[model samples]
Target: MLYNRASLTNEELIKLYKQMLLPRLIEEKMLILLRQGKISKWFSGIGQEAISVGVTSALTHDEYILPMHRNLGVFTTREIPLYRLFSQWQGKANGFTKGRDRSFHFGTQEYKIVGMISHLGPQLGIADGIALANKLRKDKKACAVFTGDGGTSEGDFHEALNVASVWNLPVLFCVENNGYGLSTPTSEQYNCEHIADRGIGYGMESHIIDGNNILEVYTKVSELAESIRENPRPILLEFKTFRMRGHEEASGTKYVPDQLMEEWAVKDPIDNYRNFLIEEKILTPEEDEKFKDEFKNTIQEHLNATFEEAPITSSIENELNDVYKISSPTTIAPNSTTQNIRLIDAISEGLRQSMERYDDLVVMGQDVAEYGGVFKITEGFIEAFGKDRVRNTPICESAIVSLAYGLVVNGMKAVMEMQFADFVSTGFNPIVNLLAKSHYRWNQEADVVIRMPCGAGVGAGPFHSQTNEAWFTKTPGLKVIYPAFPYDAKGLLTAAINDLNPVLFFEHKGLYRSTYQEVPTDYYTLPLGKASLLKEGNEVTIISFGAAVHWALETLEQVSVSADLIDLRSLQPLDTETIYNSVKKTGKVIILQEDSLFGSVSSDISSLIMENCFEYLDAPVKRVASIETPIPFAGNLEKEYLPKNRFKEELLQLIAY
Candidate 1:
């Protein structure tokens, strides 16, 4: 705590000390509530208060900070009202997450605080996105993102570091190495000499800080932040601290050695800072005692008030509306004239006109820039837009998707292009847990479109050509779109780009070049979740999307009965109205899809028809899809494995029955 520090006045020093003390007192009371059964859980940051307080006090309140589970000091230091924080703990309606999440799991926009998810490393990538947005806007604002020693082992840690350094985004990645990651010691977490050394490898600067020393941290981080904002780039700071409590209250600290606790307890940040203040005659002993008493009483007062607020009432209707925002694409501003194009060209031209229409639309993926995508959907994007908007990311799928979430957190919308749809499995956690649940858990809208080029026919085999719409259509928050033709591709993608929720747009590799249509080359969008009625007949109905629709189209012509062919442009927000009406009109029906039969979109549609339109059927429903096996590489095996061969037989059986 003793150093020739920066010129922080005695008044500012006392304020910082008090800020550190407030969270300690708040947690102390919350621990009491936990014992009394008023609160279910409490993640106490009792020992490591100085890092959050000191680092936060140094940065401007308008700049963003992503706090970890133990960083209550960040909220208090930024003057986030105590009542709301207490409400969060009690699952009250007034909390930031509307009681959807507990403890420091929620972040408040009022304080520019971005709360981290359970998987900590992803937030680091998201912080990079915020820094990227700030740099693009020339806001001169920097961000402070925190992670733990255990989090350093995640692939996202390496991915985020490399991206931030290469892009030179202004971010202070503060790692609180508290010796253990839930009983795993720092010795096992990494083999390096120091965590700070990893920063050098990423071509970023590094610093070591004493986590318990309030004076040292405030002065050092204040200087570090000023330097970063002036010349934008990332710098890593390793704060050596100790977790005085368990990971959460219930997970006891028995794994942490008694000797280690004794060593860190002696370096208590609040006790040390208060003693230094008294030594310098900056504060009397009476004032120190008074500050403690005041904080204790203030926290109790807020706790009592928090209990008075209503607890979140359970309601399915409330949750029904929570999963997605109502669609409104009219707000988009881009415009263009008409042109005839291939399905692949419509995709390219749609994005070109979309970028022209929407200034905030940023396209990012591996080899997407100069090389174009592997499919060339983003061809000439780099030349058309600058490198900043047309970003070519490192091969880090998880980090790339999370970074898009970060961009959308700011005002910008992003187009996250996966070189292949099968590769999305790498980013599943962030998408399903973070992006999909974002709107349902919180009111925030994730305005980004994830483009996945999928489907079989090019013999890309199991790893690349699989159509996995079932993976997302079942997920509540995401909109899954799969188009079969050129015109539908541009319209649905534009709608997805303009959508306020996270969207999964699937493009068929088979249809990209093979299918051609004269389309409106302007910025336009078709109805999302609305099926295109390609043909109308009274005998039987066929519902299909993506490449399988073409197969269904060809197969239905061979059948005796006239059929209603529905090209379902999107999977989720499934045009239930169109589906139900079509099924009622024609008693016999078949649901066709490129994906395998087991647990696929076809099965769900079968269930939907059975549940809603069961009595309308003259015969049993049929599903025609690929066989339930991994796609074969042999060309003949691949040809036999697809749904096209079965569709004609299935459609004729339904009509004959």
Candidate 2:
């Protein structure tokens, strides 16, 4: 009752047989490599080869595929060289990730494939964004993202599916229900009758098929893919299959019953398909045996050469190379015009100008459409750019951040705004793990600017009020920008959008209306890693950023102390030249930060000054920062907790010392 072999031509039937046979041979050779001590680990798809081969063969090569670690057949079907696969498994320097990552954790832009992280479900949202980009470009291409039955339990799966369904994006969410998630069975994971049925709640077209039936899988998924390309919509496909071996070679078969293994052994997809091919007269018995022998020999050759190749040699110094791309400062004309603007207006104007300059720029966040965001920063953007460009996403922080990688990798720049900086915790994995390490691993550009509305004084409480720049300062490959003045906010943000790296732009909610400055009317940019010298003095150098800069400036005015004030616009790439020069002039240094005192950016700066300018110090570096507790809800408690007055006290004490 499945797809009939009589419905296909002899050539099509032969191609299907070869596709299924190749991954099976590849997995077998991989196991041999594991025993020979060439590969450290192997996550094989022995029983699930039909699903990978069928699904990949259904789609065109131009359409993108975001595959999991077990889906090596997708790479093989894409015609990736056998040498690269063997090299990657052998940990040779010629692998796709240059031996930086093992197994299937490598992809190239030329192939339109983005490899998976250890966390599986985030790629669903990334595929959603790629589909969105295709829609923007009016391309009739769809993307397919794969995951296992256990991955459905992740929150990213639900968020991505919901968004794809809502926007009618061309994404195919495939769940290879292999009966078990590691050691746990399906009954323990979900209560649903079938994983495919869950798609109905999201209003997506759903299908469930026998995964071992290659003809059925190829026919159904190919039709569904064509439908998705013609009219953009998500399709949830669940393939019911089982893993023949244990989770890994090291895992014994004690967990799987002998009776279950026997049942699947009789129904082996390769054996059944070969018999079908003979019955249908597609190939003679001798021809089929010769075909398989040829593939086995080819795989053996690649495996043999892979062992002869040199193992990847790397050092700690190699890791320090590609954290950030070297980008020059933006050039501004000498006669550029200026206009007075508020801090928030300057930020909004910068977003507008960047969008005008780049055709592929998208501005997205929660309540950012007609509602103009919670802070009204994007009030009129929807009218100007339309709903497609100015998107209003749901309150799913992880998906919002995950989509940025998908957009940027597909020839687009994204400006993502978090409703509040405190909510960034929900999306921390992709931000720190994936986006930050993208360029370092594969030399891909993550051109994204994540706008974070941070800080206290608005009585928004802990959930809404937070300055989380410290959390990202330790992460490599991310540029952190926290501007105090309106001019710097506009200039820095503009430069961040244009730069070829991931940037976290922190804008304080308190400074949105309080700060005012004459910003440029047209376009201009300030260089990153360059600190602004606000007030020059010879006694002590006070280094700060964001709202803390204003507090330090106010304290300096009231104390009448001759102290050098430095506002660090960019935190990650610290302005060592400016800080060292100022330390030479003023022998004393005081670091003031508004965040919690423990593990603060101020602590990092203080340590840097101590290590680099130890001789220039007249006294040990002093740090004045917030108390080590949550920002309080009450107005009086919040004021006492922040204690901006402490800056003046700390400054006066340091001067006396």
Across residues 433-500, which tens digit of lDDT does each residue of candidate 1 receive? Answer: 78887876767788778999998888878898888889998888999988899888988888888889
Q: Local distance difference test, per candidate?
A: 0.87, 0.87
lDDT of 1 at 603: 87
Q: lDDT by residue for model 2 over 509-608, one digit each (tens)?
A: 9999999999888877788778999999999999999999999988877877887899999997889899999998899999888899899898888888
Question: What TM value does model 1 have?
Answer: 0.98
Error of 1 at 213 (Å): 0.8
Candidate 1 clashes: the total is: 1
Model 1 misplaced stretches (Cα beyond 4 Å): 1-3, 331-338
Model 2 residue 504 lDDT? 95
